[model samples]
Target: MPHTLFIADLHLSAGRPDITAAFLRFMAEEAPKADALYVLGDLFEFSIGDDEQSPLNRRVASAFRDCGVPVFFIHGNRDFMVGRRFAREAGLTLLPEHQVIDLYGEPTLIMHGDTLCTDDAGYQRYRRITRLGWLQWLFLRLPLKKRLGIADGIRGKSAEAKQDKSITIMDVNQGEVARQMRKAGVRRLIHGHTHRPAIHRFDLHGQPVQRIVLGDWYTQGSVLVVTPETETLQGLSLGENR
Candidate 1:
């Protein structure tokens, strides 16, 4: 039975050796078994630019190259700077912010899910600025040291902002999610960003729809497996590695 795997919010960095070890294990032991793999976003804690080619990034790229499956990556809020260079090195196909595809014969919409957090006006404004072509080009031209400093500053501010924000504002907005689903003409939506993993079934314009949220890999690994007849969310425990 052919099946597809979806994951997101790994936020992989050099500091988290435990998570990194788990991810390497996953690529070697689990991902190769899937027909295709979709990484919705935040694959890294922060990607200053593709040119850095840090040791950690190189390791991840090598792992992806050896995964033995078609891998696709969507830019997340944290790692939106992941460009073509990185994708090519990692042997991954880069996807747009929102992509609609036929999944086992069903129309499915996949995204990084940040755009759906409309209630967080501040974050949305930041997203708009960072996504601008001119601004991104200018940012990328800075020296590697400067780029890293800026990323660290921005990350610090983001951390502080989250402390002041309510959970509801950080999560996806229902209306925005529905609007995106309608635009994509999909009854099933798969996304990651909020880091809250759950299956949501609702009625949209009298039609039944479902939304699946993928969790972060901060504490454990979360994955969604979809086949012709079934869709399931499974968590891989870090304790198992002990």
Candidate 2:
């Protein structure tokens, strides 16, 4: 059956060779079989800039290009600093932060899913400030080493912040989800950020709706396979499903 694939939050880094190997395996073994692949967000642990394409980035780009599948990406919080140079190299198109698309006859909304966490005001504030064009312009002008240092510092602080927050506060707010669905006019929404993998079904304005959350690749791979006939959420084991 013809189908599309959705994945996100791989958080791939040179330090995490296991996840990188799993992703490469996936690109070689699974992604090529799909009609199209949508990478919703956070493909990298941190991206200082597209110009600073480390060996890992080059390898990932080669993998994506060699996979021979139409690939699309949405900016995640961690990779928002990434630019089009790598996208071109990877043979992938960059979509808007949130997009509505025709999903096998149904309208589906896709996003990186960070903005839905209305409760995390601090993170939301950080996102807003970091996404500013002028700020990014200045940041990108710095030396690559400086940029890397800044990125590392920010990543460390973010990890510290996460440890202080409760899980529920970090997750998506139901009201925000509903609002986004209504605004997008979609009955189905797919996103990945919080690393909670589940298909949530609920009533929206007396109609059935689904919010699909994709998991992170911290331990194993997560895939959301969708065809005209069915939607399946499966875990692609990295020899460590436990």
Candidate 3:
């Protein structure tokens, strides 16, 4: 059976040795057999532009390339610095957020889900600033050591902010999700970011809509697997059943 696999919110960093190992194992053992693999985003804790690829990034990219299966990626807030050259080098295609693709004839839209952070005005402002093209270009030109230093500093600050926030303020806004679904003209939405994993079926404008959320690689792991007979999701841990 041909199967499509999806994962996200890994937040892999040079510092996070466990996650790096887990990710490599996934690529080597599982991903190659899939018909397609979609990395929704945040695979990296921080990507300091395209000019300097971290050792972890290089290894991960090589793994995907060697998988001999189609690999698609979309930038998340954390790794938005990923560019076209990196994608080409990794033998992966860059997928646009808010894109609709036919999945076994079912029209499905995919996103990183950060745009649903409409309720969090402050974070949205910060997102806009960091995503600027010129700013990213300037940052990419710096030395790798300097870039690493900056990324470390930024990660520390982000961790502190998350600790200070309430859960409600950090999650996606339901209203925004509905609006996006309507705009996309799709009844199915798949995204990763909130680290809350589940398949949600809801009523939208008198129609049935489904939203699938991919979880984090922190506690355990979550993957969406779609085949002809069934569309299933698996949540696995280090020693858990796959």
- As for TM-score, the candidate ahead, 2 or 3, is 2
What's each prediction's clash count? 0, 0, 0
Lowest summed lDDT over 10 consecutive residues: which window, candidate 1?
A: 233-242
* Alpha-carbon TM-score of each model against the true structure: 0.97, 0.97, 0.94
What's the lDDT for candidate 1? 0.94
Clashing pairs in 2: none
Q: What tens digits encode model 3's per-residue C-alpha lDDT throughout 109-189?
A: 998999887877888988999988898888888888999899989988989989988889888899999999999899889
C-alpha lDDT of residue 135 in model 2: 96
Ranking by lDDT: 1, 2, 3
Off by over 4 Å in 3: 239-242
Error of 2 at 45 (Å): 0.2
lDDT of each: 0.94, 0.93, 0.86
Q: Which stretches of candidate 1 lie over 4 Å from their true place?
A: 239-242
Over 1-242, each residue of candidate 1 has an lDDT whose tens digit, in order, gives: 89999999999988787788888898999999999999999999999999988888998999999999999999999999999999999999999899998999999999999999999999999999999999999999999999999999999999999999999999999999989999999999999999999999999999999999999998899999999988899998765432
Question: Regarding lDDT, does 1 or 3 come out ahead?
Answer: 1
lDDT for each residue of candidate 2 in 1-242, tens digit (9 for 90 to 100): 89999999999998888888889899999999999999998999998888986899998999999999899999999999777999999989999999998889999999999999999999999999999999999999999999989989998999999999999999999999999999999899999999999999999999999999999998889999999989999998777311
Instruction: Superpose all Cα atoms of candidate 2 onto the true structure and report the RMSD in Å to 1 decimal.
Output: 1.8
